[model samples]
Target chain A: MIWDWGFALEILPVLARAAVISIEATLIGFALAASLGLVLAVVRIAVPWTSWTISVLVELIRSTPLLIQIFFLYFVFPKFGVVLDAFTAGVLAIGIHYAAYCSEVYRAGFDNIHRGQWEASIALNLSSWTTFRDIIIPQAIPPIVPALGNYLVALFKETPLLSAIAVMELMQTAKIIGSETFRYTEPITLVGLFFLAMSLVSAALIRSLEGLLNRRTTR
Target chain B: MGIRTLVAMLVIALVVIGALATQESYQVFMPGLLQGAVLTIEIAVLGSLLAIVMGVLAALARMYGPTPLRWLATVYVEIFRGTSALVQLFWLFFVLPQFGVTINAFVVAVLALGLNVGAYGSECVRGAILSVARGQWEACTALNMSRPQMLRRIILPQAFVAMIPPWGNLFIELLKSTALVSLITLSDLAFKAQQMNQNTFKTIPIFTLVLLMYLAMSLVVTIGMRLLERRASLGLARGKAA
Candidate 1:
């Protein structure tokens, strides 16, 4: 049949479970990316000796496709005696791939902070850690929230790549349902709709968050 | 040596050492990976050309067309941009065949990549066009130039310069995305890498080679786009002087 409502209903629960996997992967991966990205940015700034190495590593990650990285982690790491399950492998690949992007965003935010703030912090005898925590990070983070949110949506969409190594996320689940029932219209369409809805909701949330941050800053 | 140069040399030395370690597998995998790399470039170039056309049309429709056309453009951009490109590819590859519409795998790859990038490029096009000075539009109207003449002669040249940098990013994104086409059974770089991995189980060498190929392609795209952007801006500068 062209479009089977019954088949779509039959597969809803399965797809929904897979959707949870997709969402969880996105959230966990994004968390790893955010923290790792911040660390990379900090190292590039704070440790001059290592900055070039960090820059090259980030560029190497950024230049390649996420699919290749996933394949490398999934297939290649086992050769080095690091045998991660598919889920962990997918998360690590996605996390590090996007950490490159998030680091760039963080770098931009840090660059935008005025030099006078650093000078003032130094004048006040604040420890570097206290200065970053009290003065710099608060200023840097608000501006980059929207950019970070965009990556969140991007990461959510990218969770489908996990399927290549057999993680069985939403798109993979949809593909299985399609093959089983020989009905492509329902499950695939539903998957697309689910992505579109989640993206729109996240975009809306990001906009409001940006506005809230801006208002607080202005006040 | 400066720290940057020293670090760069160190990284190169490490890479050369790693390559020496995997030297034997290079002969087995290089030819297939090279062939796949060519296909990846082919897909990226063809897909980018289509995306630029779609982007310009959709951007114009949204910007200056009638309300219905604007609405249609908005819907197209939102739906395509909001969903995963992988889903779009799967839909084209798997779903269309069910409806008695059969497109070859290569064409499906091009269309899906083109459409997804086009949706993003449309926003850049729209933003660049809008960013053109209000006075330019008013000047064209004052001169009694027709809408087409105004767009072709005045607005588009300025907007084109603005669009190039974002278009470059989209082009690179399209190149990276071509790896996804391997899923539909195209013998692109990622697919060849996978095939070689399964055949030899030399995963480290095979994947490292594929990753470097992709990085090399990305560097080519980045350099190529920079040249294009420079040329476009030079033309714009000469136009202003004239």
Candidate 2:
């Protein structure tokens, strides 16, 4: 009836195990998003021919909800003979959805590079790939680190949506515990606390990373 | 591509999709989805209004309230912002009943979403207010205006222009979040799509329709906010001159 400390203590291990799955989803999903986003951003800028389509695709993904996107992948792709397990579908959905956003951040980072930098790279007769690798990305990525870090936190929070397709992430695990034991207060409250603590930790880490980057750049 | 070419192509694509959706097969799902869209829009509208009010109040409290009030506002903003919206919704929907508080699902959806978005909105509000030049506040004080009077006539009008774009963003985020309310059994657009999919197993058409509907709503919000930003900036110039 009331908050039970014993029950809360008992479920801590279960929640911790589930939290690892959620963490795995977040890390993998974020890595996918960050890389895919960089590729999307570079394609839009470097290859003039593909810019419009890429831009529209990014817009469509960014505008739609991630929940529906996950459903589309998990549910609809089977009709096209490309069925994916729930975890895969959920990870792909989150990665693609946030890639749209992360691409914009990358684009903004790229835009901050002076026009002279590109012209200089061209004047030096450097290949586009070499220019992007040696000149553009190194300068662009540092500033956007904080923004990407925030998305890492965001993706972690979103792993619970995987539970909609039965991925057994933290929230879903907690929900099951609630259903079986009929005491949601402990598990759900613990889930909330886990999210809060993780996000705060990530936020602090991001701040330190920002400071470190600033020091290196300035030096 | 040229803007004209892009618009023309987009319109053509929509027409093609629209014609296909008119077939009897797809028509069966429309009424249910439309009903859900209506509820989604309703929740988004109500949630946005509540978010704005809470945001402004919290920002003001954090900035100008006494120490205790500021601390309370800080905790509210941090706790709400730090946790997931779905968790907030579930805690409200499932856990509160144990505490003898049984809110209707709709109320819980709006409240959970409004409070969640409001936490982020407060930061936007705070930033906008802080960006209002210190000179403006001093000028208001020089004219012997009270804090509330200064905020009403001078500070807010200026900060409002800055707030519109971020508020627009928060509103769209709120709209996307309404999809989560379906999990609580409110049957909003996303919920309706999943329900229809379960029954008919027509996942592709159903999800495509729902995604497009969501895209259309977000586009409308985007355009509306852009127009409002333009109007606000125009007013901002007049305010600045005065």
Candidate 3:
């Protein structure tokens, strides 16, 4: 079939509308992963018993595919008499799946801290809390900002998996439009373009955020 | 809480959720999860094998091939790195159908994943090779080893150990990406979960089991990789390190 600019133009608005859902899911998932990851990292390192449990939890989460995990949360919770909407389930699954990865990132950060930092803390008679907060974390984060930024991009791209469970995210929306018109080209193409554009924007935003954080850390 | 108590609580919660929930009938879900697990492995192993070869070749090309070949490899690496795998998946599956050559979903997935990993693996291979010191190459030359023999006997052995760990991670990612194959009606874990969701209307148990199956497979892969890594690294890891 010849490329149809007319069909593509007509589908742009619908794709744009669906882009909103994808963007929203990414935002909320990012926030959740960020916070939950911190909680996991702190518990794993601070309390020995807590670390043991957290390690198991982290391993369990990390070992599985996020798509399957999303399916689990989407399918299973309803049996416990807690029925989540498709959108809530999708986003929760994505966020929960990613929290595991982010925790590992934070843990990797801590691991990179040389033993000398701990020695300095002891020599200075500083509490572990003060040492970690003031000295160790500051030094650890800069080198890892780029990697962390990469995960955020990964999390954003994964929003499409939410569509499998009927979340009406960009891809799902495009699929519906494609079916209605029998014009898969227009909707799917636009959806791909939308994802490409948004992800590029996200990469730029993360870079700026990394730059700002680095500047603040240096000062 | 103690670690035991915490795990007990989570297990209890999962059990309760599994018990009281009115998920789909077990029969439909059970067979499907098992079959999907098998398919997941098939795609992962085969695709990873493809990726390893392509990755090594691309790495070698960039390091020693003609200028144009090196440039082509570089562009391939950067473009794949810059884009999301999901986009790559869709393009391979959906876009290819428009060209009147609709390969099976499994092949599409294998190709997309292999190509993507190949890009990432090239860097690992290149890095591993670079880490092989000039002294080793010189020693090989002194021993009257040809270029190919030097690579096979001296340089590659050192580089291979370094390649193992990252390749393991990439393999896990490959396994996970295989779930996307369910979208093309491939009867994989994700696909089976979808079918169970459709037939039983019991989303949770079916999916939880599917998730566990994935976790189990991934654990096996991870543990196996670690063991191999330990063995590989035991003697200066004499081969590839990436």
DockQ of each: 0.69, 0.71, 0.39
Which parts of model 1 are misplaced by more than 4 Å? Answer: B1-22, B235-242
- Which candidate gets the maximum DockQ versus the true structure? 2
- List, residue by residue over A1-219, the lDDT tens digit for candidate 3: 745898888778877788888889988998899779877886777677888778778877776788777777767787888889988998898888888888889888889889888788889999867877898778777767777777888898888888788888888887787678766666666666666666568778888988887788678
Best candidate (score: lDDT): 2
lDDT of 3 by residue, B1-242 (tens): 23354345446545644553445555456666778778888988988998898899899989988999999988777656555566677767776677677888788878888888888899999998988889998899889998889989889988888888888888888888888888767887788778878877876567766766676567666767777877888857353564
Candidate 3: CAPRI quality band: acceptable
Give me the iRMSD of candidate 3, please: 3.4
User: Alpha carbon lDDT of residue B234, candidate 3?
Assistant: 86
Lowest-sum lDDT 10-residue window in model 2 chain B: B1-10
| Local distance difference test values of all predictions, in order | 0.89, 0.90, 0.78
Q: What is the Cα-based lDDT of residue A9 in candidate 2?
A: 100
Ranking by TM-score: 2, 1, 3
Residue-by-residue lDDT tens digits, candidate 2, B1-242: 23354355446556755875798877888889999999999999999999999999999999999999999999999899899999999999999999999999999999999999999999999999999999999999899999999999999989999899899889989999999999999999999999999999988778888888888787677767877877778834534452
Clashing pairs in 2: none
